[model samples]
Target: MASEAAAQMNFQTMEHPAPMPIDQRTQVLLTPGFGTQFTDHMVSIEWSDTRGWHNGVIGPRHPIQLDPAAAVLHYAQEIFEGLKAYRHPDGTAALFRPEANAKRFNDSARRMAMPELPEEMFLEAIRLLVEKDNGWIPEEEGSSLYLRPFMFASEAFLGVRPAKRYKFLVIASPAGNYFKSGAPAVSIWVSSDYTRAAPGGTGAAKCGGNYAASLVPQAEAIERGHDQVVFLDAAERKWIEELGGMNLFFVFDDGRVLTPALTGTILPGITRNSLITLLREEGLTVEEGRYSLEQWREDATTGKLVETFACGTAAVVTAVGRVSGHDGEFTIGTGGPGQLTQKMKDRLTGIQRGLVADSHGWVKKLG
Candidate 1:
């Protein structure tokens, strides 16, 4: 099997002879902001249509050389994934729900007309990088090693078709809290002008274009003094979609949880999925269906919607304190982090940090 061959593939590692000194590395780990500090090494793998995957290498982190006519430069045939490696209480490293990331990466590849990597190879690549960069895992309370695995077309051709060659690489950074506001919760700006994705588009794919398309609206939100932007559906521009980089969830006063359904225009978020499971475990009703901006405003005004939050790999679960739109602005439940929001964050972080029992076997321990 192709996957079997990839599993047997040996990675030649060339450790950095002159890595960052202990003192500097320690200082970086102390206050390393999100995606600002890097580890010493990375993983690289090459693939071609003729030979399949080969040349697995784990080498010192450095710049990548690309030809001027590289397909990715022109066509943007690329996909990426984000995950984290946690430092357990016993000093061991673990990954939370890595298999899910692997699956999503392949799904994105499929949608982009790129080659689908073997799931085993994806998992192995992550393991190799984390093992070699073991010292980079920060021990800070809310800090971890952020892993970014990405693949891009490498063929130096200008044609608008799938490239014959590709490269996959995994890099890591030690990250702390994502938000620097230090507020109890975050504020969102509803974008009535721009939409994130449209039907039968690349909305479900974890590719770069989706995020690229959201930058303008995000800038508008920032200009308006909001923390993030929440986009509406492209078709009608009335249905509630998601945030610029995260998924949304609404908590009602009657113990009901609702999130925007995935209708080929929403990214199926892993954190959102996990929280749905956790909410069900707590005997709460969870619904994934169409929700409109009008309904959101009405609920918030009538005190029916008690809390709202956004979830992603970087931010985990962040409470949406208030929402501002073209018409006006309103607050959600005291304009601060709600009780259910804190509970979900605590339970999830507890499982991740090994402070609680792993009932679902979501934690994969690494050496």
Candidate 2:
């Protein structure tokens, strides 16, 4: 049924009239700093209660016009997904685990009470945009085209109910390394005053509000000279849930790994899931269970916990070198990128960029 609906949903293409010149684009791609530079084109689709999903367009990247009373402006009915298009060695482009992203996008929509987009339709939108703007993909070693697909309530109503109209848009950004600190590993600051999500809240949803609620704490972390902020469970305020925008993992000395269980709060990260599979395949014990702040400090101090890392789509895999909060600071395994962390990052990135064989068939090539 979703394949049938996707086949019927046609996208009208309109090329950019005055796209960026080749030389200028090359310069921009040379050092495309994360999300600052954008591609020439974007994808847009509209949805409504009566019309369903219609009016699909692949056109120039432009500003979005919204009514003053739009529900998204007030109620924050928005959800989004982030994935990347990698330029392989053979001059071809591919996406890693895009199907996972599509599924997660719908999951977020379901949680936010927004209309679910067909998985096939979601992939089709991404394919159209990537193919149309293929030239924007950076050829650098660690660079790719970052794709952001987002949906929001477009209906101009002040009511407290779900909006009847919605709009979905996909934009491409030429991205480089997500972190600019050039540190061997990133330092994290534990947030004691602010929590990311409650048990029945939107923590698991990739909505704007969850991130908005994290801004103050994130700023506080930065002010304290940390790269990222790690949040604790709202109820206990001791169990480590996740970082501001990534997931956590603890590597132990006994060849066992543990990540905080997804208890309706932590975002089910695709990178985190893939790493678990890879670790288990490598004959390592992987466990998904609650890890507390007290336990983390104790294990690190006692040499039980050797390496800790954070995973996500943007940062891929980054080791947690130092942890600091009101209680004090502690170092994890020489306070540098651990050997296991580097190995996992290399393995994951190798599979992503086609340097290694993809036995899991996670990469979807755009031909």
Candidate 3:
């Protein structure tokens, strides 16, 4: 385990405050609903044109000081990544596909006109923080230590150019499942009003601006009594895209699974990728291609679309109950988790928790 993890991410421990003992009750809150809280410690590193990346620190959680004129504020030069620390039954803690997060972080940085963090440094930051605050790891079912790593232009510049100074930091949240309210099916509002990205934009990169852009549309969906917003293609606004934060998947009654082709406008969620892999392993046929809104609605009405879901680090695999668009509303597959969706979720979670054999060797044990 160590060797495989080392090949992808190297670690350097940073000392921090002594961990506080977590009571059984508190631990119960940690897992049941995962990411609404945080751990006690955080990891950070600084970067500049002259000094480069240095002054690594893993310490008690605290607010960071930022200049009012920082480049991140003026130009919106920022990027972020998310993953989790899962507590195994053996009292050990591990991360699922952390190296993938590190790689995505670099991709975001490049797109945001910021400097990239080394793969080793990114991995080490999460490892040290999770280990230091090992007590904060929730022991509840589905609970995890949500690790957020982000970088932004920290230089106090006024011009509209990329700043050479930046800071990278990782904060951990003790997360419950994203839908603390319940695991009930969620409704999505189809948004043909706004475009998430253009062809040459930061659509695929896990950056802050994309999320910032999603806030307004998401608010509209909520106002309309929907749980989330789904976007269509930018140019045509006819093809199905993805949710504001998660990737979309469709299942057919005949057992064919399909997700949008990576057209550079959709975020390649780690969970989405994992599901494709796990399903294929179970002898399921998976398709990655464009599925238009008209085609989807027609299929659902004709009983072809059996299940629809959104995938992300926070939600894992959430069943999509209904899709409401400006034209009309289409309820999908009795608006519940389908047999295939549930089975895929179980298999993916099994691999994450060490409950099943990891054929792909995705788990990276931290201890």
Candidate 4:
């Protein structure tokens, strides 16, 4: 299988002579704001039809040389994954379920008609980057090194079929908090004018096109003074799908939690999955099925829906305090983070930051 091939390829490390100065880097790391600051180096691996995968290198972060007719620029054949490397309280670096990211990345590749990378290769690339750029990881509470691993078609020919050549790279970012509000909750805009994905479309795939299609609606949400945009099912435009970049969850007054079922149109979020397991462990009745926006409004109005929140790698878990659209607006649970929402966020974040016991074996400690 592809995994067997990946085991044979050794990652070659290249020297990066000019790293950021200690004083300057320390200052930047002290107040690193999300993805705005990057580390000194990166990891890259090239793939082709004739060679499978070759020319692996961990070197200085630099501008990539691409052909004028590169397939990624023209056809947009690209996919990416996001996860964080945590600096534990014990002064060690670790990752949360990175193997899960590798599996999802390959799933995205299969959907995009791209080559499947070996899981071992994916993990090794991440390990290499986290180790090389160890200094970029912020030690402050709620801050970590964000890892972005992406692949794109690089063949120069302008053909309709999949490109024979491809490139996979991993980069790191020092991040603090994703939301600038620093509030216990976030506001959402119901995007009735724009739909993120359709049935049997690339919605399930974590590709660039799915995000590209959401930018306009997301912009509109921001213009209307919302933190994020909530999308409805493309078919009926009635049932809830997810947020622009995260998955939605609804908690009931009766202690039941409901999230949209994966109907091949929603990104299967790792954070969402982890929270589901954690909720179930606490004996919660978790339901994965269709939940219409009308039902959401009715439940919130009648005090049936206790809380609403979204989950992702970047935001972790954020409560949905307000919802608005062209139809009207509504508030959920006094327009603030509910008790359960805050509890869930705290538990998940605790496990990720290595403060609490990791019973699920999700944390992979690094150097």
Most lDDT-accurate candidate? 2
- Model 1 ranges with Cα > 4 A deviation: none
Each model's Cα RMSD: 0.8, 0.6, 3.2, 0.9
lDDT of 3 by residue, 1-367 (tens): 4344335442344444555446743754545455556666777788889876777777777798999999988899988999988888899998999999988888888877788777877888888888887777777777788889988889997998999898888998877778755756899898888978778899999888899999999999999989999988889988888999999999888888999989899998889888888888878899999999999999989999899988899889899988897889998888888777788777887778778778887999988
Ten-residue segment with the worst summed lDDT in candidate 2?
Answer: 1-10
Tens digits of per-residue lDDT for model 4, 178-212? 99878878899998878999988999899999998
Over 4 Å off, model 2: none
At residue 8, what lDDT does model 1 achieve? 77
**Segments in model 3 whose C-alpha atoms lie over 4 Å from true places:** 1-35
TM-score of each: 0.99, 0.99, 0.93, 0.98
Deviation of model 2 at 130, angstroms: 0.8
lDDT of 2 by residue, 1-367 (tens): 8888788898998979999999999999999999999999999999999999999999999999999999999999999999999999998999999999999999999999999999999999999999989999999988899999999999998889999999999999999999998688999999999999999989889999999999999999999999999999999899999999999999999999999999989999999999999999889999999999999999999999999999999999999999999999999999999999999999999999989999999999996
Candidate 2 is scored at a TM of 0.99
Q: Find the candidate with the highest TM-score and give its number.
A: 2
lDDT of each: 0.93, 0.95, 0.84, 0.93
* Per-residue lDDT of candidate 1, residues 1-367 (tens digit): 7579776779998979899998999999999999978999999999899988889999899999999999999999999999999999999999999999999999999999999888899999999999999999999898999999999999999777999999999999999999888687999999999999999999999999999999999999999999999999998999999999899999999999999999999999988999999989999999999899999999999999999999999999999998999899999989999999999988988888898788999999996
Colliding pairs, model 4: none
